[model samples]
Target: MSEFFAHRRPGRPGLAVFVNAGDPPLALLPELVAMLDENEVDCLELAVPFPGSATDGPVVRASADRALATGVTPRAVLDTVASVRPGLRRLRIALLADWSHTVRGTAPGEFAAAARDAGCDGLLLHGVPPRLRTAHYEAVRRAGLPLVTTCYAVSGPDAVAEAVEHGSAYLYLVAHYGRSGTAAAWDRKRLGAVTATLRSAASAPVAVGFGVRTATDIEFLEGLGAEAAVVGSAGVARMEQARAAGRDPVGELQSFVRELRTPQPSHTPADGRKRGIHP
Candidate 1:
């Protein structure tokens, strides 16, 4: 099992933030990774830059555009991972790549091998074709790399089964099937049932993603049997806002992560920033 998922305890769900590898710039990622490690955040789902993603929202799509404009590539992302591996103490890096955009020319086994060689603790490949699913799983198995398989919350039995079976690290249970970060409301009842179902079937932990913005949402997911909440668009939005404002995106992230663990009032703000009437 991956170190991040090894010493699991029954408690509130863990937090995993996603970021485009070069949005904050590849040069500063090691520092950010170190900060996240120092804060003991569970996982950093680092995505390589890709264009025209069918599932990403504007926040994340904009992030990818920024990253790609800066010439971020799969090789650079993996190299960055390798550079930071020695400094890591607790935080694990999960490299998220798109099969169509990032791994098109490479074979599944080769891509898995490259990720394993690059010191990735886990991997989740997006946009995989149905015909290549078996090859993907086989390659991951051959490389002895932990896999993060995903299925929509409303996915049928076969899809869910494939996710649970191959997902040795964790199963990413998307909250709904729309573009990322666009859901106006979380389907609490449906999510609760599906989370319960996946947890019962999988030996590994099950994580919830998509439309998970607030700390309150994380709390609610914990109540519904999710082991972790993958905080994506919101995190990227915070980083982008901070970056544009001449603020430290990593510091902003640290604040965001801290807020997730801090107690809040009956209705906590989604952004978790305390505002003043005078300001």
Candidate 2:
């Protein structure tokens, strides 16, 4: 396992924050990455802008538009990661891209090599299904960069186990069954069941994401036995809000991170026995 995934311990669940590279602008990336690391963000997921993203919500789509408008290319995103890698010594950094972005008019192996050379520890192909991503997985493996795969609630234990057998650094579970940034409260019962299934079937850790917006949500995921909780659109939304208000985006992100890392009372029942949520 990479050092990023190794950060998880007994009591604390990991936090992964996502941001579109060059959304507000690429110049701010180094500082933003540094700030996240300083504030205890375990993983920094750097999203490369691609057109017509089917899974992106309005906030993420707007950020992608802004990034594309600023001429952010795959190469530029890689370069930015390389520049920030040294500063983020302990933080695990991963690149999130679509199949098109990963291919980039080159062979999959070649593209993976480029990303590895640019200092990314792992790669997550956002819209590609695990069964259909053999070539991409092999390429990432050949480059020695970990491949992060997504598992949906609907995808049963058999599928998740197969993905683990195929060698994923970790499995990313979609907390809800829709686009990112949807405001629905997570289905705690379903989430608990699915997480339990994944944990029992797979050796790799499971990280839940999609529609995760607040500290309470993070706490809930931790309670559900998730190895990490990913926050994408929520973080971007906050950054946009900070910029509009003439506030420091880094400071805003730091405040949010601190809130997430803060310890809170357990959700144990009054009888003092821990509730039966499967780990």
Best by lDDT: 1
Query: Model 2 segments beyond 4 Å from truth?
Result: 101-104, 129-132, 265-279
| Residues 1-279 of candidate 2: C-alpha lDDT, one tens digit per residue | 365557665678888888888977899888888888777778988888877788888999999988899999898899988888877656888788887555646776776688789988878876655465777677778888887777777677666665666546677888766778877556677888889888787776788898776676777788788988898988889889998999988788888788777776656666644322222
Model 2 has an lDDT value of 0.78
Superposition-based RMSD of candidate 2 using all C-alpha atoms, in angstroms: 3.5
How many pairs collide in each candidate, listed in order? 0, 0
Please provide, for model 1 over 1-279, each residue's C-alpha lDDT reduced to its tens digit, 9 standing for 90 to 100.
Answer: 355544334676777889899989999999899988887678899898899899999999999999999998788888989888988877888889998888878865788788889999888989889998888888888988899999997899999999989988778999888888785556667778899999999987888899877777777778788888898998899988998999999899889888877644665366643221010
Angstrom error at residue 126, model 1: 0.6
Off by over 4 Å in 1: 7-10, 265-279
RMSD of each: 5.0, 3.5
